[model samples]
Target chain A: MAERAQRKIPDSSRRSERSRRAIHEAALALIGEVGYAKTTIEGIAARAGVGKQTIYRWWPSKAAVLLEAFLDLTGEAAGAGEVGGEGESESEAYAIPDTGDLEADLKLVLRATVDQMNDPRFDVPSRALAAEGIVNLELGTEFVRKLLEPQLQLYVRRLTAAQATEAGGVRRGVDPRIALELLVGPVTHRWMLRTAPLTHEYTDAVVEYALYGLAPRP
Target chain B: MAERAQRKIPDSSRRSERSRRAIHEAALALIGEVGYAKTTIEGIAARAGVGKQTIYRWWPSKAAVLLEAFLDLTGEAAGAGEVGGEGESESEAYAIPDTGDLEADLKLVLRATVDQMNDPRFDVPSRALAAEGIVNLELGTEFVRKLLEPQLQLYVRRLTAAQATEAGGVRRGVDPRIALELLVGPVTHRWMLRTAPLTHEYTDAVVEYALYGLAPRP
Candidate 1:
């Protein structure tokens, strides 16, 4: 009886995992198509081919589902590189590379950012969420707290490490927190405003200009 | 008869100007109240106490009305400082001051930006418009071209002048266009994201960090 119970438990857990993935995919797709204001738990459940109660059982709100969906998507995108080697932890996939070259490291991540921003899969849904964030202060704060700041902190960590290294790339007094903004902010502005096309070339230019200073270096 | 006709024409022109101002004010108020999607031409016309044809004659669409309304508001804001001098041209209001000190000039402009972003008269309608821009690319591009890029170019020109005046202050090879972003991007990021409060102090910090380099100057 004990052996039978153990076997049933693994099957149930696998089924639950499948259902969760389906719900996340459904939530992302629905929000992309209809936008945040119109997306609902019922809609996600319908699209996922599951009952609404099953969705409710897992997530209390559409916002919660969408948030997790984005987190999952980011994880998957980060996992595409060699960081996802077998036996590596999940956190490894999201880790920003630390090569001790601040400029090159920033450029590499930003180039990947350019790709992600341009990708329709990411862009459409992100725009939907961003539009909602602009109007909804509560959701916007939650997004910054949960999604954006965590990613920004990875840059902060890298910059802090750069300061400690003896190579002397960044100035000692520079605050890594604000320094990261000089790198990330421009790309974000171009992306959000559609002022220009965001490309790897553009991202590379931002990194170069930021590191070298705009005033002619004496 | 010719003199009488000319005098009558001026009177009619003066009346038209008043009506135009009323329409602009109405458009801003309505957009702020109902947001972009719900705001309509008929609504603006009603609020302005003008016929739909009058608004149609002046603007092609609601977006056009809102954009021009904002332009008119900015013009008024600029002219507020010009009250004592009849010789001041509209161009003077638009020009960023070149005080031979880049950091001071940047701080002045960014402080103005902080004030503009915080002003309820500007913030509510601007937020409504920005939210729409996030979702509508064609509209977003048009809005940025008509309203934002002109303002950004002023910074580019000022930065270029700074580079020329103080050769060692900015790198010669730096693109002023991209370089200006390093200054403006962080301010906008903080404002739009609400990650921090927008203040003159924050603007000063951004200018200092951007121009001087985050690293302690050698």
Candidate 2:
């Protein structure tokens, strides 16, 4: 959250924690149903069963509420059982597994992403933010920088490791940042545009195509 | 247009043509300025100096006006001087140049696509439609089927030709439909998310990586 809770007695602190979770749940549900344009702070508060002031005191605006809600959803979705150290957000704890098999690791993570995209809990609210972000530059850039880029960076980190050490690794001439997109962009494009069904089979093909060239090998 | 004008004498036909052009211009400008949600038929008519009745006479909704306007813009941007046959829209005339040199041909098309994404004439209105499509299934699916899928098929056609004959052509194992996404997706993901500056240099690299494979050549 942008603002921290004030010093409080134990009883009140527990109440505040409950309110925060409720507000996050409410924000997610509301955005899923009505989209960002139609979603309002008052509406979120009403659905959350908290006072309007309660929302404002914790968040600066509706966008903030949705963003925090999204972050929370992403955290729960990243339930790999590893916990972040105190003061580390769950996002920090999330990392692409470096299993030494680049192809295997990528396929595993990408299949999980496909599953997340299919999950309405993440998909609906994510679409709300992505739609709004397309038209609203500030919000779009914020989410990309704060949320999306980090996830993409995990791919970069993995590919970079491969380039440095693996046999038949990613080409050294390639930029890991751009190369990561080859894997990510196809899955995301399919999901965002609804051009085709996003499936484990499709993602496995993407991984196969990206790692090995399309052209016949010499 | 969804509705054809009533049978017109030459003088009236000329005037109708002028009104159609004006409405197209108005729709493009208004959607860019106000976005899809705020843009309205009354606003478009007011800007075009046509009666609301005149607009309603031909198009069913603002979405229709914008779709045609977009088609016209795409046609103009595709000003390769090859006009479609009678009764064929310019979209039909559009094709990935088959120079039989797959790499050069793809680079040429991707470069043009990058130019199109940067052109505010197409970019602004396209984003408006895309943003709306994320949340509105009917419109999203309609635009994809009518506008985007046809264009993507052009790439599929080019790739299929490559697979058939090029010496180092696409491997027979690769699916042309999925393969096209690897080429198209990265450029698009970067453009839509604003993660990085989309340049000819970036697209060149994408083509290189997608064709050659990120994995080192054996």
lDDT by residue for model 1 over A1-218, one digit each (tens)?
A: 88767775457778988999999888888888988899999999999999999988888877889989999888788776537567765544476777777777788999998899899889889888988887788999998888888888888888888788667467787777888888888888888899888988788888877676665555
TM-score of each: 0.88, 0.91
Worst 10 residues of 2 chain B by lDDT: B1-10
Interface RMSD of each: 1.8, 0.7
Chain A TM-score, each candidate: 0.89, 0.90
Compared with the real two-chain complex, what DockQ does model 1 have?
0.55
- Residue ranges of candidate 1 with Cα displaced over 4 Å: A1-10, A81-93, B1-12, B78-93, B166-168, B215-218
Q: What are the candidates' individual DockQ scores?
A: 0.55, 0.76
Give per-residue CA lDDT, model 2, range A140-188, as digits (tens): 9988988888888888888999999857378787899999999999998
Model 2 stretches astray by more than 4 angstroms: A1-10, A81-89, B1-11, B81-89
Residue A110 deviation, candidate 1, in Å? 0.8
Range of the 10 consecutive residues with the lowest summed lDDT in candidate 2 chain A:
A1-10
